[model samples]
Target chain A: MLNTLFSGDFPRSRWLTGLLLLIAVALLLAPFLFPGSRPLDTAAKVCIFIVLVASYDLLLGYTGVVSFAHTVFFGMGAYGAAIALAKVGPGWGALLTGGALGVLSAMVLALLIALFSLRVRAIFFAMVTLAVASAFAILVSQLFHITGGEDGLSYSLPRELTPAFRLVQDKVFDVRIDGRLLTYYLVLTACAGLFLGLLRLVNSPFGRVLQAIRENEFRAEALGYRTVLYRTLASCIAAGVAALAGVMMAVWARYTGPETTLSMDIMVNILLMVVIGGMGTLYGAVVGATLFVLAQNYLQTLMAGLSSAVSGVPVLPNLFAPDRWLLWLGVLFILSVYFFPTGLVGRLRGTGSGR
Target chain B: MSGSFESLLARLRGGDGARRSGLLLIVALMLLALAGVGSLPTWITLTLAGLAMGMMVFIMASGLTLVFGLMDVLNFGHGAFISLGAFVGVSVMAALGPWMESASLAVNLAAVLAGAIIGMVVTGLFGYVFERLVVMPVYGNHLKQILITMGGLIVVEQLIYVVWGPDAIPIPRPETLKGALTFGDVVLEKYRLLAVAVGLVIFATMTAVLTRTKIGLLVRAGVENSEMVESLGYPVTRLFIAVFIAGSALAGLGGVMWGLYEEVITAHMGMSVMVMVFIVVIIGGLGSVEGCFLGALLVGLMNNYVAYLAPKMALGSSILLMVVILMWRPEGLLPVAKGR
Candidate 1:
């Protein structure tokens, strides 16, 4: 049953399997194990990013397509939910409606972009997407009446999902049984289901063709596969899943804005997580998201400590300033591309040179 | 002179008349704008503003296109150099505050020149290191090149934040260059005129180098087929490095101009302008200078006209132009035929 669940693609390396199990257990029991709002928030974010980055990997790693527009779809999903909830009033029905709206729009936009630009060279597609995504971001900001502009949209969730509503009359396992906890679990569950769906999609016969296309498009086409059709399909699927991740984010944060969802920084962060986790391996997304989120949360505190420790130094404090953490991550990203192009999961699984 | 002009036109048109069509498109766009705008002075001002903006974009994009042409290396981190150039140039201008503030045109010009030269030198040197460290390893692989260059971009941007702080620095234009040049009812900004002149000089010099020099021939040949050039005993690698440095230097010069034009400099400015730069590069064709120039002008003119006509639609004008142009000519307005 477990093998079937994973589509028979087990984490071949024992260490990898162990790490995956540990992450799963920790996330599953996050409320009980962590027992704090911040920790729980971090856990929830890890879940959303895992799905987001994995969906990206489906295109970048599995299909060998580099798209800068993934975040645009993510933004669409987020805005769709934000606007729907704001307009329709927050409820489970609203959530579902927003999510469906987000998913459909993302798919349509992705389809249009794929059909129009996918016929061109990969580099050309990357440029076109970058241009389009930036333009979309501008449009969103300009049409502030609908999107709340740069300030973003913040609205209430269903009563049961708000912190004011308690799930139980008393505390359970030293944790407050409030709507927040329920929402976390809801996000976690949705992410798990979405992630599993992606695993199933990538491991199917359709997935094998994507990998084949990634390896050699000419050969795949010569072998009678319509490469563009498959690529376009892969792009659409990735876009839809990315939108779903955005919906999950909206539910968790109860707010949506261009800064949080559509910014180029978020796009860069997604790229970093996907690359550092290991491309082509679904498990990498889980590991990457966990590591990146944890680092994002804790690394600043660590840097603050180091900065104070070297208070008297001339330039060292600035270098180790908490905000400069991305500099180190950038350096790490470059090094990984050169030395460990396969990423941490790839290394653990004993995958040789990167594909 | 007329005969020489005819010969130049013939050269630009080449065998396929790509450049001629690109030129005609630019004319058509202006005519459309003239009709829509109706007022000739407003049209002239908009056209001049558009041309100046186009010149600045061309300066930034020319090097990028050549680098892409010479080696299929699309440096996603090209914006890093642009930012670096702007920051460095601004710093130099700040240091030369006295000269910059002077009422004399020559002194103010000298200060700006100093900033541009120093900025170019620093960015050029950085580009060499960037080529060696960030770009050299990912040759021949498009995906890795994109990833690695992007990595370089992030690191450099963060480093800029660390060094310059996360504040937008205001740039003071020279005293003589601050006001507008009045041509009867049509007034043009003095800084923009300088920009146009600088852009024209760079464009002319670049054209001369590419067409009239031995290195230019080798670079052009290298872009078409580096291996063949190498087998013919030219050092293709050295040529590529030179092109990369030159490209970085030009981007730095553009950065300086862009900073003064905006009257402010920010690290993120490079990234923001990069969208326009990419549009221009793609519209012009990957490696063609003439194409890049025409593309930049088209985007710039379209941007001003659209913004003036409909502020809301202004955001998408360049992108709309790109899509339309791409639909018409998939390889761009003037594609440099590349040999694999």
Candidate 2:
């Protein structure tokens, strides 16, 4: 029965299942093979970004809502978790509490925005969200007493649950373990759970309604479906998932600030990952996150090498470093929109061989 | 007087009268209140500053509005054009400093002209290339448009950084316009005054071209119904190029003025000012030139007032204005009429 449920006549499902299993195995073996703080750290960060991009795709690709303020929820979650750990305590209970608070806040905010701007569509929704996010950034930044102003807030965490679990030095087999490996496993577990949840949701009746609304909201409304309600629910869920990623980020980074919480860069990064990988496809999120992280790392390395080779030329190697990355990204985005609207994964699926 | 005011209001609200008088009356009252408060600046100074700032905002917002209204392209790299214009203009002026000093007024005017030319040519070329290569592909797809434009923005910004470096560069202000003008205790910067004058000239020229020229007519027609215009065999693609060029040039011109106003140019200016320009365009009804003018003034004043109130709030005033606008008029103050 399980095989029949999993296996469909379409070859795409078989390929997808196979690819997913391969990825799962690779994720499980990553820590043991890499055995380093940096590699594990990168892997963990990639997982967090994957979750973030997937959440963004949930709304943009599936629901057709271009939410500009998605970062606000993510930021809130980071701060929520940070505050909880700092003011309250760092434990599983605290993490759950922080996630719950972030989700509730996001849901309330989504409800208010949706209720007010439900009549407006497309670009109008984008603009309003942009405004709200900007306002939120300013509000948080200005409240220095709480938000730590531009300097940002900092807090120390209690000792790990088991000091022996550290990825860098071990006593049993003389293998080293440290926080990076721990973070990697934690993030990977979260991502896999969320992925399963999202897959189930997308295949359910509720997901069909979302697709119908995305295709034509007016027609869906005429059919007696409450489009706004469904959209709001999807948006809230996306926000919650994004918040989960944010919480993980805060825990991993061990530092939170306005820049980390609500920068436009985060929004751009999430958007790029989702679009580049493929929209409306779960695997697209994974692909986008992987590609974006790898490409950015490679580009920075290349730039750094060039800067070092040319003596006396001060080349700033930062996230906001002046480079052709943005230009290439822009060109790629335009090309994707024009030639491959379904994204790289979608195109591959169309070929009938990838499946 | 009260009876006449009420009648005039009724007529304007009913769309029977032009509402020009009502607008003037409101402007007059605002000016009076600004002066009478003693807390604010003199009426003339406030109005002059507001109008000048408004004019620049209008220039920036017009291009943004046009692209959004006509093609539904978000044009995320709109700021790149502005930064490009400023950098190019300032560089030209710096290069020609000797000639400008010897022939002061002539040199300054020439620099302004040169800046406008460079800004228009370079940015127009960019617009054309971008439209054909980047924008053309993502015509109706919002996600692709957003991604590609954003990517373009990052690339352009990085390129600027590579060329100009990270530090802000100070452009030499015209020697003749270095001092401030004092009007009975109210002091105004001469460059700002010059900016106001130049902005007005550009506004007038744009208005004339858009309203009077044949190309302008086609642009209007294109905006209203792009498919119909294409079907008529009017070289719709060429028309799009013209519109893109003109819009980009306008942005470049605004960038020149911005460089002069700020006295320093940085690569991040494009992204920083983008949100404000977006707000102005949305408020101005997306496609209406006249609406752009009105929207710019409203945003400019609101921005200044917000700055005035910032000491108390800690954050800048624009954020507050954004929230208020989002809450009250999410479609913007003047939503474009559906179906063009």
Candidate 3:
């Protein structure tokens, strides 16, 4: 599988490979080495968002499409799984069935939207998608009987995946790892596999064509490539993979809602992640998502210290408050876009030129 | 009906050709349909309500329309201006409670004007900093523009929360603008009437500035061919800054009006308006102020009428309106005549 993935490469892609390998190793060892649930949970979230953001990059970075409807696909995956699990109850059978159904439905939705709107100018298509996607979110919440409305639906996971189904009660390295650790590992492996799959797809000939389309749509059309079909296919593929990420999100959080899964905030976050990690570079997704989720998880506590330090200062405490980390994240996002348009990965590769 | 409205708007915006009339005629027909479902008085009330809402939307969206039209900047952070305006206006009004509570119309109007002036000035000044610090970096890169502007929005919203507190705050209408005006069996809310009047004044001012003056001429010419205007030795850069400041001020003004209309302000209020603003901008044409006016009115009327007639469909009505509009005219209701 590695040979197949690397076959077309010129073999100059060393740094990204090394970085990705380092992350993979860290994720594998996290359960044993990480001491607390907070960090572990954050790690798991980073994993899910890595796939989610990379799939978005597939469209934005690769195919030169800016879609605002990505979270809808992500939401569909969670909702599909949540609704299915609610109906089928919890088991390996239920999980697989619901997850498969969820992923497939998300792909279908993406495909339909792409096919319908891809013909318009890029900006107009974006607006159409935005309106449609927001409507979908509202519709989901309004379907109170089926969707549980604003409350959102949560269902049980398989018993073996639950924390109570412990392989052992205690831990090594002062880490009390057991069934919950197993869940993290489950999420890790799935996420890693999905990330690898995305990397391979982007490195493949199809991905090269997508890059070509992004570089110059008319030139690609002149070369006889079916641009619309390719874009639509890319959208479908990205959506399918995003749905997989969504399934993992549901499995991890055991909950999904409009705010968590379908909000425009999440959509913007994914966009920021992809851009900050660097567009057109697959590893950027992992790097960006990891950076973002970590910052979100840890920045508040970091800010909390600052807030308290400034407590003696009038008005400074409020400005430095922990809850205002999103404000900081926003600043970081803008700064990254301005100074590191190639993103962290791109800068790491010593390519500072903007995408 | 469509033709008449288009011609009217064409004359108003100084465009030579008739634009799409579907929106105006369709909106009128929708009102007619609503009249069939409810009493005449009910329809009139809803119509007035919609016009007021539409007026507010236009006030907010016109700035966006002009900025996008002139600079080609897809400002995702336009919401920040709105939020800033609301916060500034509310803060000013909160501090001037006694003036607002005065029974004298002149005094009440003074307080409101004071609030709006402060809101506009502060937002305009912030627009300068925002343009320099944030927007300047991502010039000509739409993707980066969107991402960075959104970042600007988030930071500004957080700042608002820090400054104004996260909870929604009430901002009552001035005493003189607080009640309704009744004419026999038909009644009109005073605030709505004020909104309509203010909307018209803003629209007229915008039209006059765009059509009658040198800056307006340059802006219109810039919209048609910015490079050409630049080749004529005009400082397009300065013009860009002026337009940005103007657009920010307009958004602030609209925000103040909207806050008063809703009687509550929050950090996320800007976001709530962003969707409708975008919808209106799209339906109007990316850069056409006149189309923005028509589109806002259409969305406003449709939203109110539909909410009253079918509450379940209300959430999707504006979106559905956009879809319908797109189906009929893919380039928008009245696309810029040249290269968009």
Candidate 4:
């Protein structure tokens, strides 16, 4: 089946493959090049977001379901991991347990939601998910004693859990052992593995069915496909992957809060990444995440500088600053919708497709 | 007719009647439970709050319903327009505060008019752009519409944050509309009443326009069947633009009312109120103005009352209502007329 699928002279050329390999290698090594503390952490965090955005694309871009509450899965993972680590002690065991619990929680929630709302297409589905996620956030926040309310939960976990894995040692360079650096490698590896797995899934017959549903659900149903089942499964997988990213986040941040789990802002960010990068394209998720995070970081820095420069004056700083980054993001979204509706990747493909 | 009445009476006297009575009894018991368990005061407060909040909801829903009715587009970014209105209204009020204070009521009215005009213009421009750029391409494509509009929402939200800053800003209510009014034991905020009044006025005016005016007729016709309206020589594209602008303006109006009622405006208002607004739209039935009104009122009441009864369960009530409605009437309480 796989051979038949790739029988028509593989679409990608040797040069393209080589270039992709180089980019992947560069990305893997990029964190090590960053000397500073914050920049390296930021780079690692961006990878987590890239994983998140990609997982979101699995359902949204590929399966054609616009979920407004995808972050709930991620949050579950984070909280689950945090609880596991706090209660069971930090080790590989806790990490794996946290991941399993997160995925299980998402699966159960997705199943419940899917049973009812999966049959409803488009806006109804979006609204239902939004309601569910919002309710979850509210419930979590209100249960102040357990979830810690708005302030969130924090704990201490060591970086070098397995000392034998330290392959490099250079004390002359004043390289301090940082947990964040180790966390970054682990996340990178996980994201890469997941990305490859998603690639395989998208290439499978199951994926074709999903795409068929996206193109025309009625037609797919007419052809005897169970559209709801496929969609539900896709949502489950997407949620599980998102949970994986969430676990990484909890380990990295050492804190979990209501805001982390049930935030519409995060939902918006993920949506923006998918749309801006390009729907139906795997690399777009990473591209969009990179652009969004870097732009936001730089915008804030510039805004802060401008604000300080005009300290004596009462005028608001530049509109494109970090504080005002949401405005820019909003504008970008509108512009993308209006002018470049297909998004960056779509726009690029348009030239080749001669559309 | 006598035989029919007798049969009806017989049925009422039988097991069917018993079942009906049982159902009614259950409903009555639930209501009593709601009232007896200290839920009445909470319900009243929530109802009032919902009513207060419903005014804005109605405004937003009016526009949303019309757009959905006329064009089968589920505008995900509708909240952005509401946010735009709030930001613009607050900024204008803040800017013109001094000028309005020294001037007469007419000047105050003028400031308000100016604020509304600004909101309408800005939000209309946004609508026009959205229709032409975002909506025009994905006319029948729901998935594409969802993606593009979701993107549009983010862009609009970020733009507001950039222009207005991240923090919430206060938009001063007029001096005459600043405080709460005491009626017996009830203390109602004056601005909320004003908001409701404004909402009613707009609702009435919109109703009139749809029923009486030429454009209104076209809109109504379009809602029923755009192709038929187009075949009759009306410019349906222009109608779409007009509807988009009008809908956006309603959202803006809602935002302004919200700013006044809450006494604070933030970039996040669009997102914060999004779920409730969606609930209103969904419950009211997509593309029905009357449905929007009823939905908003129901939601407002439920929202306020539920909070009062179980302060911790504020979010649960809306979801529960939605679930029940969806299960019973999936097409909503007032589904848009079909095959028009």
Give the TM-score of each candidate: 0.97, 0.86, 0.92, 0.84
**Residue-wise C-alpha lDDT for candidate 1, range B20-74, written one tens digit per residue:** 8888999999999999999999899899899999999999999999999998999
DockQ, candidate no. 3: 0.60
For candidate 4, lDDT tens digit of each residue in A1-355? 6454333213233433343455566567765556676776667677888888888888888888888778888888888887777766767777678768977898788877777777654578888888888888887778767667788777656446333345456532554445455766777888778776777788789988998988888999999999999999999888888888888888777788977666887887787888787677776776678778877678777767877777665455555345666656766765675577556766655564566
lDDT of 4 at A179: 49
Worst 10 residues of 2 chain A by lDDT: A2-11
What would the per-residue lDDT of candidate 4 be over residues B227-297, giving only the tens digit for each residue?
99899998998888889888988888787777777778887787777788888788767787866776777
Cand 1, B chain, TM: 0.96
The worst-scoring run of ten residues by lDDT in candidate 4 chain B lies at B17-26
Q: Can you write out model 1's per-residue Cα lDDT over A1-355, one digit (the tens) per residue? A: 9987888888888788889999999999999998878999899999999999999999999999999999999988988888989988988899889889999999999999887788876788889999889999999999899999999999999899999998788998788889998999989998999899999998999999999999999999999999999999999999999999999899899899999999999999999999999999899899999999999999999999999999898888988999899889999999999999889998988843333
Candidate 2, residue B44: Cα displacement in angstroms equals: 5.1
lDDT, residue A266, candidate 1: 93
* i-RMSD of model 1 (Å, 1 decimal): 1.0
| Candidate 3 CAPRI-style tier | medium
Candidate 3: lDDT of A258? 89
- DockQ of candidate 1, scored on C-alphas against the true complex (2 decimals): 0.77
- lDDT score for residue A189 of model 1: 92
lDDT tens digits by residue: candidate 3, B204-313:
99999998899999998888789899999999999999999989998999999999999999999887788889899988888889889888888888888888888878
